[model samples]
Target: MEEYAREPCPWRIVDDCGGAFTMGAIGGGVFQSVKGFRNAPVVSLKDSLLGFRHRLKGSANAVRLRAPQIGGSFAVWGGLFSTIDCGLVRIRGKEDPWNSITSGAMTGAVLAARSGPLAMVGSAMMGGILLALIEGFGILLTRYTTALEPRLALATYSSPDPLAPGHLQVHAR
Candidate 1:
């Protein structure tokens, strides 16, 4: 019985080490969360850009879905481009979405400290309003700038080849 108990002690040590490694990974995850909150501006900018791209893609899809069947291949490509352009316009107004959170927090803190109770409440309200406005502005700007404009163009097949008989080759631009 004593030998068996001692034999498992080494295995227990290995298990403890594994537990410690997992704990370390969890701690790292927490650290990253904190860091992400702190770096909200950078993250917000990235998000705005991504949103713009998403909206642009949605616009392009809308065009492809709505286009009439009368046009030839050039017309199809032109229609796709026109739809993408509209999406770009929509996205351009939404850049810098995070700008308000970072800037508004600082501005709000300063105003809150400087003002009286009534003033503080008023300032806080104003801060909320300002933050919302800025966020809206950033989103619109990003959509127009990144999504609408052809920053990088690719010429992949927009539709399935009539010659090919399979569903896998049916591409949408």
Candidate 2:
């Protein structure tokens, strides 16, 4: 879990390698041939669920990465307050955690200013929206995080060597 403050861009925390990983596709033929196991009902169910979970988790992670990078770059290009407002509106609509947090901070800053009654009301509405977004983001993040771990564990543990000729061998360290 190393953090580096580089240029603003979406980053993925992939396994420390620069190669490709294959995933099963439609039709049981590819999976059955690679794993050398006839597709049973239970196995098919498990594989399908695992694949769905992986796709969901990966998409969530990508969103988390891109949102911050885009927000940061926008903040740099636009004024910080404008970026904060844009972030808030996006989060309120999309329910992203980072955007919600930024929105909250911005609302607080705006409210602290001695402004008119309408401005205060607008700030309060923004704050309420930010809260809702935060809650939604929390629920989504938890669901996706939980789903990812088991799917990844299954994939890691169930590695079948396609080159080998016989039954599946669980590799031992």
Candidate 3:
């Protein structure tokens, strides 16, 4: 297990839940606002200003009312995902992208189980694919950053003399 993964399961769950909730709430608010604005009734040219104000107010209300619901759903998904991930780590005796992908698939399926088997299967596949993409991106990013480290070191500047600090030279490998 990684040093960071050593945290207690409950704490991980809570942390993931909180983070997911914040993401969902902000995203939901923006989505709801856009939806509300799009759906708001179109008023005549004479009432354009009033119509704009009405649309804004409507969008605000939609965000206020819907954001929390979206946040709660995201929290549930995060908590469940964290729990499954912790369990997988313990069972598999390793930490890797597979664990994350499996956890995401299971979480999605479990959450969608209420709807039907088809939905569950679809959700599981979707979740797994999504997680795979995320993990792949993360891996690529880490590699990209790691590859840059040597170049960064080589690109560092070195001053030739302490007396003349204004002049510096780049030493490239």
- Local error of candidate 3 at residue 143 (angstroms): 1.3
Q: Write the number of the candidate with greater lDDT, choosing between 1 and 3.
A: 3
Query: TM-score winner among the candidates?
Result: 3
User: Candidate order by TM-score, highest to lowest?
Assistant: 3, 2, 1
Backbone clashes in model 2, listed as residue pairs: none
Instruction: Write candidate 2's Cα lDDT for 92-138 as tens digits.
Output: 76434555455555655465458876776677567657666776877
Show pairs that collide, candidate 3: none
Query: Looking at model 1, which ten-residue stretch has the lowest summed lDDT?
Result: 1-10
- Each candidate's number of clashing pairs is 18, 0, 0
| Candidate 1 per-residue lDDT over residues 1-173, each given as its tens digit | 01112223344434444544455445544554444434333323558786555555554444343322212332433333233333343456442334344334444544466666666666656765777787788668767767645633433444477566552343336
The models' CA-based lDDT, in order, is 0.46, 0.46, 0.88
- RMSD (Å) per prediction: 28.8, 19.5, 3.1
Give per-residue CA lDDT, model 3, range 1-173, as digits (tens): 12334567778888999999999999999999998887877675588889898888888889999999999999999999999999998899988899999999999999999999999999999999999999999889888988887877765446656577755555755
After superposing all C-alphas onto the true structure, candidate 2 shows an RMSD in angstroms of: 19.5
Candidate 3 Cα misplacement greater than 4 A, ranges: 1-6, 158-169
